[model samples]
Target: MFAGWVQERAGETPVRPRDGRLFVAGEGRQYVLLTYTLKKSAFSLGAQNAVLPLLAQASNAARASVPSAEVIQAGVVLHAAAAGQQASREVHTIGVGSMIGIILLTWLTFRTFKPIGLIVLAIAIGFLGALSVCWLLFGRIHLLTLVFGASLIGVAQDYGIYFLCNRLRADPQMDSAQLLRRLLPGLGFTLLAAVIGYMGLALTPFPGLRHMAVFSAPGLVFAWLTVVCWFPALIGAQTLKAGPIARGYKSLVARWPRLTNQPLTLVLVAVLGGVTVLGCSRLTVNDDIRSLQSSPPQLVRDQIKLSKLLDAPSPVQYYLVRGATSEEVLQREEALKRRLDPLIAQKHIAGYQALSNWVPSARTQAERLALIDARLLAKDGPLSMLAGEIGEDAGWAAVTAAHLRANAAPLELEAFMRTSASEPWRHLWLGKTEGVYASIVALRGMRYPSIPVLGQAAEGLSGVQWVDKVGGISSVLGRYRAYMGWVVLGAYVVVFPVLFPRYRGRTWRVLAPTAAASALTLALLGFTGHSLQLFHVLALMLLLGVGVDYGIFMQEEHERGSDAPWLAVGLSAASTILSFGLLGSSGTPALQAFGLTMLTGTALVWLGAPCFIVTKEEPNASPVLA
Candidate 1:
């Protein structure tokens, strides 16, 4: 029936044999169950293990012969390829749009070739540097690493904006060195805060999170270096006339005193804080890895169709049995198989296959031999009865161990595993690692809670692991979410105390914008009832980076009594929003969560910046700020 279905789908002579070959490839590294594609799915490595070679084979076949049944495309792989192309185009479009927006905005603001050219140059170099570092660290960057980490370009923009904004707002008579002197303190402090926020991600166990941190942190440094070491020389002291953008900034700041210094503003802040608290209390997190991937409807439909037609295993979960030897591993696996028997009978699981069932443990083999001898070869047993019935009692009495053995070959592990006949079981027999042998018991048509129940049934058995690819990755995400929560808290603890000596009385002012942004983010999350995912926490880190940067810049602008720098802050915020705003709209759940959080949080950061405005700069206020 499956073979007919494949032939029907392909409209050809049985495009390929419809057989269960899930574990027959890669010598047991791949899973047979799947529900998503290779690009965004949590089980990407396993999916690629199955699909990538098939694609390569198809390509080679295309070159070698006319198109035939062998050149069939798996639905998931084709969907993944389409998704990849869409993602690349989306990223490219966003990149080009951001660059164009920045160039035009900068051109309009600075009205010079040098600053625009330098900004573009700095951004390009910073991006290249980030890619190079990621290549060195991860060898090959994962799709999510680029999808999430690419936002580093936005972080890098902050430095360029600040430097150029400094140039814009500086004393025209002041030389470039004096301008650098004034800009250095703010830039340095911003970098410090950015690093503290990004490095929080570095502390998490998730590689994608760490890659994002590494990318943004180093990318920021390189971009800053370009502006500091190269910008001023390339673009000499140039004064800019007031344009509509500059006038718009000035007009907005003009109302800052009236709008923010009122008692109503305080009341509003208090109310917002109260609501934010309520929202945070109600927030829930969804750590399921599938929540991050959100498979396309078409791909999902295809998967269901294939599954129904082929009765294919769609096990989102599996089990790993490990022991000191193959025999021991098989024994433990056999124990689980025994446990699974009831579940299969109950229909809690469709079925399961294990290496133990195919190749019983030596002890089991011995037991089977003993049982056969006791039942048939002993006196007055089946063999003697059969011999008497056949009038061959003497022949039966002469039977010995050698004759019963019947030239049976010893079940050696190496030879059995290496043979082509054992291909179906190869994936089940995971090879030894670090002196412990491993194997997987694949369960078909299973989900969570069911696996947990099965796991409970199999409890007390040593080295039996219920590994739900989705659940396992989700648990990792949950753990690291809790972990990064602590890291973020630690940053606040470390940053505040360290900065206490400097901003003694106005310390809260420095933290105000980010606090408001965070509060607003939580409040929005609560109101929207959006289940926070791992990517949401990741997005929070990026928000904090932007929040801190905005907080630092607002302080610098108000304390210096120059609203011109506010233009830079505003533009930088806009760029960050533009980039991540698009990311928030991604089809992939992870990128969407990341982008949505960033867009929402950064908008609030922009709105909250006014609360930190230095309405009345104290005459004795220090210039040491970020």
Candidate 2:
């Protein structure tokens, strides 16, 4: 009776009997439900009614029909229940492990109680500042923003180390205020410049880069404040002395004068550059978003089960489509599906789900409803008898009115709608605020490309955009590569010339060390089979800034013939490298990139510093110099 009522209300035809089978109008396949007379199974009628609408919607939205619905029988419910439990267990495990790893790493890195407390406080302030700015600008912090902000540990530690190092090296007779006055200007200006460089990322078109820029920019200022203000006071009160400085650094710097002037050093720089260029050329950008999946165990297992059960492809691949109207959208999607059919058959694509298959058009729905009416309401039909003694014309009118009323409830017809109004579905739509509609057909389990391939099959369709396999980590990495190139070119154009405006001759000497350090870092990265990512590029830029500091320190130290400048350079480079080089051991790829760059760059800059030192005797030399 309920089925008959639903058929009447939905304007669906009653099932037709053919070869001892009943099939409803517009149904793609037929099914039978058999009930044995000897057995009476207990089930709640109210519960069944509660679930019927959801079942109906799923059936209507199903891309293919069940060949034999009775094949499930009763055990299907048990199997589904078991799968849900298994998925839940897996998710719990992965989430727990990930949390533990984050906490352990954080505790291990910030072991020094006093410095760690100050660093944590600074990070908190910086995070709040970043959160406020991101909230005001974008209205909410994206998931990527949190990840990028957490990764700022390597960059933020620089401030603390610089402050602590200066405090250790200060004359015991000098007060805390005097020590701060000496270090603050250099640390403050350098950090300000670094913040500017990071903030410049906001100019990029990519959302991830913009989020990173917003998060890191404010963090820099807060970190600087903690180091210059809070950190110095803490160190002064404690009367901290320099613990054993790395004696290896002094040995390393002792050879710098000879290494800088060597013919082999220039040759090594050129060779390193050549190697870097070749290796970098071979490196490809990976845009696969799946690379970021640190998915909880249960989600991964559930995904695997879903893929097996439905023979569905991975949702990693995406097809970008744009059109002016619903018809154009459907037509384009239909056209793309036809092109994709061969790929599907070849297992290039497992399966595609799209709105074009379900609705087709509003005109199509209206025509299907008309056909359903004729098929169900023939003379002496079960539905006709159920309509309660009405004349044929009156019965038809009553049925049509019911159908029209059902259709009027937009939410009821949601399954029939071309696009869903749900959040997950909204992600697939790329509509503008002005009502221009667009959709992406995501694909899964595509073959990984080792080399570039091009063609019509490769190029899905003309007039429609095809993102294909480019929207994940590879895309982010590619943007970073482009940004790095721009930074390198821009820094040379802007920074190098500004440093030595009066003397072009001196500029080459400064650039030589920076270039050597950059090349050596790139070569080290390449030799290790590590691709230079965005963080590496930023680190390279930072290496240039540090290289300038070293050059200035060495030049000044050599002129004064004092041990203090040498001590400062050694201690400063030591603190910078120790803080950053430790990051090379990080589990995260981004942090590793930062560490490797800093480690190689700092090592080379220290080696290259003495080349900038003036070795010739002064004309009017004091007896101290003589």
Candidate 3:
């Protein structure tokens, strides 16, 4: 019933076109523009109703049933349904395989059902906790935040395996408490450094990154706690046997000495590092926000098709106007339009739309009526002379009064809002926001320069705000990338001071492996021709913790007791790589970058771990792996 009402209101009118051209009533434009009601799921102004889609479908079904029907109800959905549904199905199918692969990898590596269940439980707890926290903060979870939460899976996987691997390598006399003591410092430091990075993320203005930081920092801590608190009590110290996989891993890394131990190799590695840095310097940094999302090709094509059919490109920028009263807002919009009119004539912009165009201010309306009287209704005016020539039936005053009664009446916003005509342009009205009447002037095909012009024009006007959602998001990314650079610099300054008391002169050793590992990984990215993005930096957050974990854990393992130095660290590193490598292998650009960063960084850290190993012959171990 409501659909019928809407149809009748938007249907063709009796007023004929001038020169075969008519203004689209609601838009106040010479050309007809198609309208799409895009519903945003967050921070909404009204209730959601699914009835529109159902009505459209029912109308289409009726038209199909009745061949006599002259028109059919259809939408862009008809052209898009198959591709969209197929894309969703493919995504789910890929996700299922990835989840199964994670289970199988953990199962095969641990060679037990208990470790699998334990690790999965920890991940589940961590993921659920992150989601719950996000829900509390935003009142709803964002899809991007969920992506960040999923990134934690690699770190979560490491937390479980790190402690569980220690169980496999613990001494015969070792108690659960002894194992906890040995692992505590390393876990604590790695977790702290990671949390610090996330803390920087939380400091940013971007809500997505802030939520990611909140989700990850606490989620990782809880996962680590699960390992530290429960893994001991659950798995007792019983000199557990190593699987065949462990033996092979040990034998493989044992060759680290021959590969990296020589002075010649060290000098060559330094040269390679220099070359890598040079190459990385040559790589470009693109902070374009569009690259962050990898929309499928079919979806992209469908969007283009829809936009073309609409006969208007989407508006990328908005000039928001405000006032204490509706009249003030309308007057302000008229002034803005005057400025915009010149730009349109010069072809700098396509056009703009606002409520003011349809409902001119009362002052402007009076001016219009006076201009009509002077030019056409006066005794000597063109219309009066034409009336005399054509033998008119009425006097000038009668014709003038009729004209005043018909077209000279001003359309106030309140009265206009009650009419059927208002429904089409109602969204342009932001309503009484904070006691200020507000409306948005949407600009189409606008360039960056137009943004500054619009903002400058509204400078003296109170409550006027210029908003460009796409540009603003892109700018935020550009700024945050710069912010994280400062954060990384800050981390280095803070890290050295904190570690100074513990390692003193040897503090340099603690920093070397990660420093080298990070540089080489970034260099590898340059080598692969993959541009670094915010995701790469976020992935580096995970890598930072992993590198520190390897260095600290290896140092702790050496100081304490271990049947095999490389075995426990290797297992932990392998699980991280295994987890992220699989995730990166998927078709997502962001996930692939993340997985690649973790895979490369962790592998390098593992290879470099033996650099800190002190053999009996030398306290400063000869150049080995790492």
Best by TM-score: 1
Candidate 3 lDDT over 364-482, as tens digits, reads 98897788767666666676666667777458546765665586566689998889878757878988899888998876555566666756656665656677677688787777777
Per-residue error at 100 for model 3, in Å? 5.5
CA deviation > 4 Å runs, candidate 2: 1-189, 205-219, 222-243, 246-255, 259-301, 313-415, 418-480, 501-512, 545-547, 615-626
TM-score on alpha carbons, each prediction = 0.82, 0.58, 0.77
Instruction: Evaluate model 2: give its lDDT.
Output: 0.55
Candidate 3: lDDT over CA atoms?
Answer: 0.66
| Candidates 1 and 3, the one with greater TM-score | 1
In model 1, state the lDDT of residue 452.
Answer: 65
- Among the numbered candidates, top lDDT falls to 1
- Name the better of 1 and 2 by TM-score: 1
Q: Show the lowest summed lDDT stretch of 10 residues, model 2.
A: 33-42
- List lDDT for all candidates, in order: 0.70, 0.55, 0.66
On a 0 to 100 scale, what is the lDDT of residue 120 in model 3? 77
lDDT (10s digit) by residue, model 1, range 157-237: 888888777777778888877777777877887888888777777877767678877776777778888888887676556
lDDT of 2 by residue, 104-186 (tens): 43334333356446655665676677778778888766444554455455456555655554554456777767877865655
